[model samples]
Target chain A: MKKRTILGVRACTWVWLIMMGLTLVTYLIGQLGLGGISASLTVLAFALIKGQMLGDYFMGLKRISGFWRWPVVIWLFLPGGLISVAFTLVG
Target chain B: MQAQAVAEPIRYPPGDLAIWVFILAELAAFGAFFGAYAFTRMQHVELFNHFQATLDRDAALINTFALITSSYFVVRAVASIRDNNSQGCVRWLMAALVMGALFLIVKAQEYAHHIDEGIRLSTNTFYMFYLSLTFFHFMHVIMGMVILAAVAVKAKRGGYSATEHTGVETGASYWHMVDLVWLILFPLVYVMK
Candidate 1:
């Protein structure tokens, strides 16, 4: 497969805008005092979205083989599960 | 070039796999810490909430942005090397290093502010975990900067090419891993009110 050149400024601008939007949503959610479950969920959602962006664009994992990709996706979930279990057992 | 003729069914470099395994092991260690943090938080939700309120969310947010943007530049560095743009590659790597340094400086400022507010690592279990985990993450950021600096030096010396930029690729991969860890850490530490 022919490798594509690095993204130009326009594409980077779009990505930056999307990321900023997510960050803003996160800030607004925090400010609204949404309590534990909702706030946690919102944060987790934003983290996952941001993680996907980082993985696909910043890490260039999108072009890698599945053998390399699957493990990373799985690794990302370990913390999420562990944190949820902790919350369930303790909270 | 002659090595390619042996035709040993080219595998993803063992060195890269070894690094991935090491990264996975680190993830497990961090998992244990997260588990502990969650368990303690469950037992003392109010205390954790109070502690969260004390955290500098704005600074954390800024640091998050910095790291994520740095990750983007690291990716660009890798791509530029593949395009045989050595100067471009060096420039991006330097940008990444600068951004990573900015994150550490902001983090230090946040730490100072926290200490001034009487929230030392020993303040409570929550603060203990918060300080330990973040400080640990900070160490990774420092290590990443070192790696990027090395890559920048190599790029400046024309040490990479379209087919042999594995060093740049691996360095960028490691830096991205640092960013990935912080993505989760930021939400858990700052937004979990």
Candidate 2:
């Protein structure tokens, strides 16, 4: 009967709904034939946001201090940045 | 700042530390694979784009929703156990397994389509990476489901409590990792152009 509620709803539920929303956005982009740096950045940005939310919320890494939180963030950004660079090169 | 930091006790993350390390290692490997994929596409943007269109975006989209929804279920499972609701936890975990099954079913159909079209690893570079990366991830989904099943069985038998549900957290963490990777994988392999 215990729950971590935020704004009257459980935190995980909120995170899940937002994740679904972001996913729909990306799906729309693909369906609309969006491309180029703007679209790429938009998609990558959504992806990065979703990944972080999953880590911090679902993975329970948001509260902990020190080195634990860095791994997921670093892992996401490092590859993400490189991937972005790669996409930008497709001129 | 030091006083505030000291005021809040330094609690470790919910799951076992070892799993987090393992998750990090897995992320590193997948990161390398993603980087390799993106850079590889740089050389053949046209071919990549061409064949990329051949992919079933609708299916990929469905799989994305499946994995994301499953992660949510796993999150709820962990939440349920945190409240000492064994039956609720098991239910949520089983729900997650169902989503994972849906993903595999859709993915298999997509593969069957590819195979029917005479697609093979040797078909082309794009198909090679597509098959290899996806198949690798496909196997992980299977592994994740197995872990969830074991955890669900244990939970059903009253093997865990509010204070001792590390097993649930561990399995949930692994499943979330699978979901997190797909977050990037979907955009990178299927959506990005």
Candidate 3:
């Protein structure tokens, strides 16, 4: 296999493991009665981490053409801003 | 002259633009639904918080694991197809399908339990949104399975190659989208007390 392919596989495995681990952490935190802003931030952080991993590895955005990469970045960022605005207004 | 020039470049079919477009539209729809959920939760913060406490965290956590595992297999399926490992791709896709089915089954049981406890959709505004959003997600899971089954059948017939496996790629992308939405929804609905 090419070096890039090997790297891709390894990165994907790491992302998957990390995502699963984060889910467990989220559950443990939830069970501990961490349900206020702390829990919300924790969930958002996990989601962001997982989202970045999925985008970079699974979606192959990291290897995408330059023309496509910026659009994806914009798509990902827009949601964060929107969610933040929603939370600020509501929370 | 030397060994002469190369012939015409081999042309592959277009990439999976159709599937990407579908995913974009689906994301937009989910965005609208999420915005609505956020807005409503803002309005009824106390009621929403109360409903959040009633959710089974363990069940939600299990479902999160299931979806994430399915997504991992989906990424594997795409990689296998790229390597021209048709059988491996089929195996991964099948695993994803099974996980999707398990998620739905668990969701059904949870719903049944809620209904038995007299927690119908009309119970409250919070319940209304909860049932509606989750049922919509459930439908997406069913659709994703159908797409995966189709891809699995094609893979079994050796229909995809390293150069022309757009179908598998597109199906996997859709499956990931479903998983992504659930990632957001799980925390928003179940953990955001």
Candidate 4:
């Protein structure tokens, strides 16, 4: 598995930092008690993106062409979409 | 907004094919559980939100960070072994193991708090789901750490090389799956209301 580097730092390092940042953002949202469908969607959006990055970069699925790469992405979006719908029905 | 790949050869999925199959199965099981939670919460919004407030979000936030960082450490381990640096690989694995241990410790504290409150799986709907879902994931972290330990011991024994370190990838893939699940689990269980 060839790891891509950016300006000397490994790509995984960058991904890790971004993931941490996103986690904090979600935490802040929770801490602020932001109640609404939008806030829930925002949190789920962050989580799904983090899952995608973990699958692609950390799991090394990015380097692969097809099949395997799609499953994780599908796994991510499938539940995410369903969960979002579930939340929206809170109308 | 992502960068292009460095135009390397088509690498197969980092780990064995069998592992991916197992991973998909695990994901399906988790997906079902999450779906159940979402629907159940929909039916009992007040109950869910009330119990969700009782949870310690700070500990969950810390655990989320711990798991993400540990996943990165595993990525480094894979890279190190790809360079045939078994020692570096071992070091990274050990770092990952430490992070895993940290996650467990924090989670254990959360569980202790719950137990002290006399919370049980039969306590209420929210507590049942909370305890069952989280404890299930907790066992996974424990199992993931054990897998990483085994891989680190193998690396220290010089059992892998640049071309033969699928074992590392396999372990990493498993760990990342655990992390991936937590990525959803944290926000789903702890944050979203």
TM-score for chain A of every candidate model?
0.72, 0.92, 0.72, 0.92
Distance (Å) between predicted and true CA of B36, model 2? 0.2
Rank by lDDT, descending? 2, 4, 3, 1
Query: Number of the top candidate by lDDT?
Result: 2
Global lDDT of each candidate: 0.78, 0.92, 0.78, 0.90
Worst 10 residues of 1 chain B by lDDT: B6-15
Q: What is the C-alpha RMSD of each candidate to the true structure, in Å?
A: 4.5, 2.7, 4.1, 3.8
Q: Candidate 2: how large is its RMSD?
A: 2.7
Candidate 3 lDDT, B140-163, residue by residue in tens:
999999999999999999999898
DockQ for all models:
0.42, 0.75, 0.41, 0.69
Q: TM-scores of the models, in the given order?
A: 0.87, 0.95, 0.88, 0.95
Candidate 1 or 4, higher TM-score?
4
Write out the backbone clash pairs for model 2.
none
Write candidate 4's Cα lDDT for A1-91 as tens digits. 5557898887788999999999999999999998679999999999999998988888877778856668999999888988898888984
Candidates, ranked, DockQ: 2, 4, 1, 3
Candidate 2: residue B9 lDDT (0-100): 46
Tens digit of per-residue lDDT, candidate 4, span B79-187: 8999999999999999999999999999999999988999999999999999999898899899999999999999999999998998899989989999999999898
TM-score, structure 4 vs. true: 0.95
Tens-place lDDT digits, model 3, residues A1-91? 4424344656677788889998888788777878655567767678767776776677666666545554445554566556556666665
Better of 1 and 2 by lDDT: 2
Instruction: List iRMS for all predictions.
Output: 3.5, 1.3, 4.1, 1.7
> Ten consecutive residues with minimal summed lDDT in candidate 3 chain B?
B6-15
Which ten-residue region of model 2 chain B has the weakest summed lDDT? Answer: B1-10
Evaluate residue B86 in candidate 2 and report its C-alpha lDDT on the 0 to 100 scale. Answer: 99
Alpha-carbon runs more than 4 Å astray in model 3: A3-9, A70-76, A89-91, B1-15
